[model samples]
Target: MKFSATKSTLVYALQIVQKAVSPRNPVPTLSGILFKTGADQLTVSATDLDLTIECTVPVTVHEPGNIVLPARYITELARRLPDVPILIETLTAGSAATISYGQSQSNIHGFPADQYPELPELPEAPALLISQGKLKEVIRQVIFAASTDETRPVFTGALLEIRDGALTLVATDTHRLAWCRLPVQADEIISIIVPGKTFTEMLKITGNSEEEDVTVYVSQSHVFFVTSVMQISSRVIAGKFPPYQQVIPREFSTRIKAVTRELLEATERASLLITEGMPVVHFNLEKDACVLSVHTEAGWIREEMDLQVEGEPLQISFNSRYLCDALRAINSNEVLINMTGPLSAAVIRCPENTQYLSLLLPAQPKPARSE
Candidate 1:
């Protein structure tokens, strides 16, 4: 394959596709980025069995061919090259590629493009168009709650549910859960469990183009996200996501409204006192104020913040990090905390926005002291 393209354009495309390449992959070709040159464009692709990223850039193609170059070496070399036109040509009977820009030239060995696994084809179905901004927001709100442990495969992915005219994304690690809902137009109802890593990479690719629309194509086993110049495909985790609706509390015995920033700050402060394991922050809600305290072998901290309390007073304990994660995910200035009891899960929501909900399981409270 022989192609000529500006260094910046080539670098950008390489950056997008390299996310799918991992050095630890057992398949040697999976560690390489496939370069396919057509009439006026070059397609770069990388895959790691579960996820694939492909990017296309305009290039001057002198000879039309395909080859797979080492992803790490090519990406690094392209990034370091000057912002000038780059000439790339395959050598050694397509076993290697030589990159030249100005006076600098480098040759790298590669595998035949035919040996690379083929990217899954999109099914013949209507694609769903979604606002990039809204998609990114929902992902940021829930992806953090996805469990990193691979034992319970379902917990390692986020559930995307589409029904009626709304779409909801839910993720949980058993300790906490995040749910975000938005209005969307779809002809048929669909549900899929997308691996957490997919969202992480998608967030980076979406960038700040809120006005742009991302086309979503769902197949039996894979999901595709297509943009103007890039396409990302990921294998859907095969299993049933936990029934999250049952875990959400239907009612609460106590409700407290407080400044979102203030609660986050208090939790962060109390976390410092916790030395080992998860930090537990004790909450004591009264008529007009909420008291947060933490006691650890190293030290103890107590903080008080004014709150608009309703219903009965209550005391609850939660992992400080969990509370912080929920609070940070909220975009509103104020937040509402609904508690059923000391042991029940506490629901956190933004008063201004009802579309997002976070549930945090309470930590066990310390026993009372003997007289």
Candidate 2:
């Protein structure tokens, strides 16, 4: 195969598909990127069995063929080339690929494209067009809460629940939870768990393009995200996501409204004084103010901040990191925190925006609770 393309275009295509390359992959082909030239476009693809990313770019194709090249070597070669046209050709023997641009040339050993695993066929599920901006936002808000532990495989995915024309994304790590809802149209009601890694990669590739809508295809075992120049597919997680609704309390004994930024800052300060193994922050809430304090054998910190409270005063304890994660996920000016009991989970949300909700597990009480 022979092709001529500017270094900038080749570099961009390489970067877009490189996310699927796995360093420790059992299949050597999975560690390389597949390049195919046909008509006037150059297609690049990479896969780790679970997820596949393919991106295409315009090119000048002199010969139509395909070759698999080492991802790291090819990507670096294109990235370092001057901003000029690059010529690439696979030898008649299909043993190596010659890359040349601006008087610099390099040859890298190549693998036959036939050895690469067959790309998975697209699922038969119906596809729906959804706003890219909203889809990107929901992914950012929920992906962080997904469990990294492999113990509970189901919790490692983000649950996409579609019912009555409403789409909600929920993720939980047993310690914290994040939920985001959006209005969408669906021909059939369905709920599926897509791998957290898939969404994370999609976030890295997609941008804030308000003009285009991402097409999402869901099936029993797979899901697909298609864009103008790229396609991403992954095996969906099979199993039931925990019943998150039941865990969220219906009512609360205390409610406090505080500026999200201010509270996040206080938590960050208090976390410094707490030890690594035990990073607990105490929340003391009164009628119109709140105090966040942390005490350890190393040091102690006390921070008093104003809050808008409803109902009687209350005090609670939680891991400062959990609180910070929840607060950072909440993109709002003020947050309303609902507490049912000291031992129960605390739910937080923006009073005006019902689309997002986060739950943080309270810390275990010490022998003597903090005042």
Q: Give per-model CA RMSD.
A: 1.8, 1.8
TM-score of every candidate: 0.96, 0.95
- What lDDT does each candidate get? 0.89, 0.87
> Model 1 clash pairs?
none
lDDT of 1 at 78: 94
* Residues 144-250, model 1: lDDT tens digits: 89999999989999999888789899999999999999999887788999999999888887433688888888989998987778888999999999899999998
- Position 85, candidate 2: lDDT: 88
lDDT, candidate 2, equals 0.87
Query: Which stretches in model 1 have alpha-carbon errors above 4 Å?
Result: 206-208, 367-371
lDDT of 2 by residue, 1-371 (tens): 99999988898899988999986887888889999997999999999988998888899999999999999999988898889889999998775899988888899997888888887676666567787777888998888889988889899999998888888999999898999999898876778998999999988884326568878887667788877788888988989999998988778988899999999999999999776676889988878878888877777889998788777788889988889888887888899999987888898998798888888889985666354
